[model samples]
Target: MSVSNSPNSIPCLLLAAGRGERMRPLTDELPKPLLTIKNKSLLAWHLEALSAADVENVVINHAWLGNKIEEALGNGSQFDLNITYSPEISALETAGGIRKALPLLNPSDYFLVINGDVFSPNLPLQGLLDQVSALRSMPNQPLAHLLMVPNPNQHPEGDFYLKDSKVTNEPLDGAEKLTFSGIGLYHQELFKDLELNVPSKLAPLLRVAMAKNRVSGEKYAGPWHDVGTPQRLQELNAAHE
Candidate 1:
């Protein structure tokens, strides 16, 4: 199933408002999303790929050093994309950030969300888009379809288990578990009930949906890195070079 090229047909929200406390002095002056990997800012890589996939409208929410993010990306013309900024005075956890950006998202039934800090060079955006497009015909549409990856060394315990494409917080005997890759296709209904402007974590919401079998996921065994620390950034840069 080919995705439509229409502008904003499938809008994406880049979660970039974290404080980056672990990234320390480096983030003291620069927001983590603007941190460079192989000479390109992390968020820049996302914008480039998203544009290539014909996803034109992107909402980037920023808090710390957000002015720099705006100064760096402007209206996203260079990337052939329309960028909208959702500014936050302080970091609003994942769910809160998405809720606040709802108005700017064009009120799509479903939208894509990607964590600004993670790096996945081969993220299959088109495939995920196609899946979501197909789901529109289902009677019991899933609230979200996440991209899961093999647990990285930093997170050995993993987050959720996947069986028959369904995501669950509970462990299934003999089932291989994977970590959430921080990339997903989400239906607006999943977030419609949340209290706006309040700090709320996304995990709890996902877990609740999972219990009802409303969340689906797929494991991606590709180049992926959760660039949470300075050392990891250095390693990713060196590996790419």
Candidate 2:
């Protein structure tokens, strides 16, 4: 699954609406995505990588301290991309946020979505881009292609099982369950049933798709970190330093 060498104008969504409850004092005033990892906010890391991957348009949804995100990366010009914000009155969880941001993410039938709090500095944006074509060509009419990773200690139970390259909610084949990397390329039909602006979780919607075998995924063994805690942030910063 390889994409053309010539860069294409791609659209992407960065989910940055979490309140970061576990990150406490650090996020008391600032949003979790704005937390600095190495002189760069976590969102900036994704923006830069997306820009390099030839992704020209980005939509970011926010609720807690969203203004700070706009102030930090206005228009995404500095990173060579056009930035758009889908502000929510309240944090609308994953599916809801994606629903709210849908208008801005339109025109492109398929788009890449990344979790704002994760610290996957080496996320394979180009690699994910490569799957767009396959998703379009598949006769199963697949609705989403996820990036899967080995479960971290905090979530050892894992989220879904990948067998025959298709994501499944159950271990039907006794395959090991893997954690969703919070990164995926999605098709609009997956959210066709979602009510716009209403809060919803992505897992339930994903489960529905999995039951129909409409979801596909690939394992990513790259360096990935769930920055859900202060200690993890400190460790990442220290490691990078």
Each model's total of backbone clashes: 0, 0
State the lDDT at 82 in candidate 2.
87
Identify the runs in model 2 with alpha carbons over 4 angstroms from their true place. Answer: 1-9
Residue 26 local lDDT, model 2: 98
Candidate 2 lDDT, tens digit per residue, 1-241?
A: 1232543345789999999999999999999999998999999999989877888789999999999999999988898788999999998899999988989988457788999999898788888897887777788878889999999999999999997688999887657699999999888888888898889999999999999999999999999999999999999999999
Off by over 4 Å in 1: 1-8
Instruction: State each model's CA lDDT, in order.
Output: 0.89, 0.89
Any idea what lDDT model 2 has?
Answer: 0.89
Error of 1 at 214 (Å): 0.4
- At residue 58, give the lDDT of candidate 1: 92
